[model samples]
Target: MTQDYGFALARERGIALGPIGHRIVEENELTRVWEVRLAPGEELGFHIHYHPYYVVSLGGGDNEIETIFGKTIATQEPLGHTVYIDEKRAIHKLTNRSDQTYLSRLIEFKAVRWTYDDDPAQARPEAGEQTPEGYAAAFREILEHTADLPWEPKSLKGLYQKMLWRDEETGASIALIKFDKGVGIPNAHAHASNQFMYCLSGKYRYIPTGTTLVAGSFYCNPVGSVHGPTIADEATIFLEIYDGPHYPVQPPWYTDPKDAT
Candidate 1:
């Protein structure tokens, strides 16, 4: 008897190609993030995304996507807009329709776990059950704009955030953060989970690494790794994607905004 594979079989027949105007900015056990920039007429060649993912527009504009089935989707996205693709099945290609360069960030989840066995009962539990609560559903956001979300102050000075999603079970969260120019934390800190930062705009320096990150830069601070005292040279905007609750060691100069006199 021949085994039947659904989209997986079809995807095998689709064209396989490298990303267009995109580069692997960061990759780890949980995610692969891509930094993409397409000039007018440039395109991402035919490809299929097997995993759930999110696309965050840095400089939104018009674009056209053509699927293997010949369906075309025309989209006009705005800056800071985010779109989630849930378990995508189609093989597609993207074309930049506008004259200006199109910039965006693509984050793909690497959460699926499978076990091979002849008996169905031996199979592992559903993906959601084995992982931390909400981790399985984190990629389901259809579309959202960070500017429309409310900001919450962190323990650090000049830092504020707008949370995009938080996994209750794992305590992991995705958020948009803003740092006021010339403001910073005075002491280094570490978190319980790995932290990934993608700079959307402005400038800042991570003191320990001595790395000055700017727009389009990506950094991953592994769990237990001590890092900045981040100082903002300009009003900086960035995204923080982390695994597990953000339990950062309190810095010496940290002051809760709520306690301000």
Candidate 2:
């Protein structure tokens, strides 16, 4: 697909570089480009994202990153000095191991529901506008103001800037999610949109399908594919990218039957 409005804006306003620097390579309907930088002794610990990402180090020293599941999975410095991991399809962390700063570039594609999979009768052109509870409600307005939260609780899951980015205004949404140690979301459900999942840290036992995923693995669930109750030990995070405005499936538990259905 041609790079259009989304890609252009990513280049114009997306984080290209920082104490670590960054730049957007391209942004289109399916993918976006990004550049990253890290200062000496800097470490970007374990985090998550929804879209699968391809990354390459542009310059600098090595960094450290670790994922804590039942065990700790650490990345040696400069592992992707030239190679990039499809993060949307996998989960891991980035850190600067060397005394000097490091730099990396990535072009990631947000997951989207395919045209053929959705039920034609129910898939209205404006379906995205209808909010699904499990998806969007999880972070409502929280994404914009959230800063680095303490890790002690271990029960909480959150997203970081390097992994997932969301812009409600432009119809772009990405989720690098974490299933905190021993925690799982509610029962299985499907969304109106297609979804992509990647393992960044730890392991997961997804209910219904019984799929176990580790770091570097990716999973795609077509729209309406019922799967969830994601459970993990040690915080597990992953990226999910999709077309906007994603609505969540109203669970049966809602007080109002109308809301549930």
Clashing pairs in 1: none
Q: Could you tell me which 10 consecutive residues in candidate 1 have the lowest summed lDDT?
A: 113-122
Using lDDT as the measure, the top candidate is 1
Q: What is the C-alpha lDDT profile of model 2 across 146-224, one tens digit per residue? A: 2354322222233122334554443445655655577765677776554556677778888767888888876655447
Residue 213 C-alpha lDDT in model 1:
82
- State the number of backbone clashes in model 2: 35
Best by TM-score: 1
Q: For each candidate, what TM-score against the reference?
A: 0.48, 0.37
Every model: Cα RMSD to truth: 11.6, 18.9
Per-residue lDDT value at 27 in model 2: 58
Total colliding residue pairs, candidate 1:
0
